[model samples]
Target: MKRTLSVLIACMIGAAVSAADLGDDGLHKTPWMRDTFKDLREDLEEASGEGKRLVLFIEQRGCIYCKKMHEEVFPQPDMAAFIEENFFVVQLDLHGSTTATDFDGEENEQRALMRKWGILFTPTLVFLPEEVPEAASAIDAAVAVMPGAFSKGTTLDLFTWVDQKRYELDNGEDFQRYHARRIQERNNISQE
Candidate 1:
């Protein structure tokens, strides 16, 4: 009985260590410093011309899920390749006091932008170049937001859905079904 108990305790310790590692790893052990808005704006401008969209990943320091997404999901070989090729990625900190002038010309700190943008939670993925010919402004307040954690499959599906402009009709169908079909299609292509 004592030997069995000892083995159980060892396994628990190993699991705890694995979880801790996942919680601490990110895109790099050092946090990514924010890029200047001037440079980012120029990059976004170029991306718009090329038909690539913006993907803003909102997170906070010390967030375990944020770390996991950056380390595990974003770094997945296929995921990284796809994101790098298709979208301009930006990481924003929700609690940060750094100022950013949004495309709307609203000058506010990051935290204030989070609130002004109606984001109540972390790990939100806000898509941009929100203008599309249908909207009045380049950044539409309503259409740019997608919140919360998404598994790898869902993340890729979202990018493809947005790229294809399927989001316009996604509202009419079951979102899960639509997203699943895209995932399956991607799998088949990748396998081929």
Candidate 2:
């Protein structure tokens, strides 16, 4: 009985530690996340002014994938540092009532905007270019949209590729090819 009780206590402690990282909104609280008025155009301008790429991170409460990313992937030193230095992150709740103004100047509740964007998953990362065309929505102007949780390498590669504006390059190496190359490089390094 004592052993079982001790084990239960340990599990509770671990859960508490993990939950502490989350904010009252149940979103993972990261220093890099911007507290904006949910205006995409202004966010884009602010990111460009800071010489950083604009990234919209869509998440929902009680999403295990979001928890995994917050605990395992994003907190890694390299990933954290890379995001902090290169991207301006704006987080949006998947089911929240907060008003969000899209790049095209259409305003709606957060959930409605998510529906309009056709986001069906938590942790959908929308990476935007520095310059967006007039009358283009956030979804329309996005350079890359990463859906669901990804491994460390994939996440990092995506961030790097978008930041470097690889999408603009005429190089035939698209994201799939680029990811494959990176995986191969890592395998070779590990083998060596």
Candidate 3:
């Protein structure tokens, strides 16, 4: 009984340490990221006189990779600075009940929106474009619904491509090629 109790305590301590290592303190920190994201939403609304495009990053509270990203990626000087300057960044907890207002005047809790939008994994990024009645079809087709973790360079390239409206120019081209090209361009620019 004594030996069993000692082993259990050791396991518990190990698990606790691992959990601490994977928590939020390890994730990316763009202090202005949240504000930028909210502003992006407002800017989109102003630009199109409806709602412009904005990006939403959805992450779970206790995810380790989420922490790794918050700590390892966002805080990188280039990423943090670029994100602050160019993007509207908001963090949504996948399991929380925080209220969110859609442009269509619909009110849904965070978790519900996650489900409605078919989000099945953590660290999903969804881009929503300004909504206009006549352009609903265009918005539906052009706005990207992406999910999963993305490295800083890849993430930056995606937004840059979106801003250039490259999607419209690549009617039938493969997505992989488009993304690869964007990545290459970013790499080349960084090298220079």
Candidate 4:
């Protein structure tokens, strides 16, 4: 009886360690992602109400890179908490048949939207400004877009940069510079 109890506890602990779940659609699910009606305008408004930035993640099932992000970087406590606190994330499947309304008031299946946005990869992150042009599609109005898998620091730095609205500044320190400086800052802190 004691051995069975120990085994059960072990399984539970393992589950907690790898918390990202595969949904019925075969896409990874995270607690921080918002399950909305897939309407960009409403999602943006809701995110603004909560004082968070709007981010759209375009991913497809069976995508190894997407799985890597879900199981690796996104599940990290700090990364997860930072995302939950600062961003309203909406996940749109690259091949999904579910209808999603774009910021331009155009409606299409998730797959169609992916093509319309000219996204060719999984794990593409679109960061939007606090306000977008009324007739612009999400891709056109995005302030920054990160494609493919990246290290934890790069991902965090991008999120931070967008959240801080550094893209809107006249300082001309773009994401590359910001990320480079952040890398140096992290290295220095670790060395200290």
Total clashing residue pairs per candidate?
Answer: 0, 0, 11, 0
Residue-level error in angstroms, candidate 3, position 150: 2.4
Cα deviation at 187, candidate 3, in Å, is 7.1
lDDT of 3 by residue, 89-146 (tens): 5666677575764444445776776676667887776665544343232124336655
lDDT tens digits, residue span 1-192, model 1:
633554455445532222113223232221222244623355467667755676677777767676666655665545554555567666666876777666656667777877767666667777765453332222353344667667888877776666666667636744567787777888899999
TM-scores of the candidates are 0.67, 0.88, 0.65, 0.90
The TM-score, computed over Cα atoms with residue i paired to residue i, of candidate 1 is 0.67
List candidate 1 segments past 4 Å from native. Answer: 1-34, 38-43, 130-144, 169-171, 183-192
Candidate 4, residue 71: the lDDT equals 82
Best by TM-score: 4
Kindly provide the TM-score of model 4 when superposed on the true structure, using C-alpha atoms: 0.90
lDDT of each candidate versus the true structure: 0.59, 0.86, 0.55, 0.89
Q: Sorted by TM-score, highest first, which candidate order results?
A: 4, 2, 1, 3
State which candidate, 2 or 4, has the greater lDDT: 4
lDDT of 4 by residue, 1-192 (tens): 633554455445544545579889888888889999999999999999999999998888899999999988887766776787789999999899999999999999999999999999988999999998899999999999999999889999999899889998889799999999999999999999
Please write out the lDDT profile of model 2 over residues 54-138, one tens digit for every residue. 9999999999999888888786656666777789999999997989999889999999999999999998999999999879988
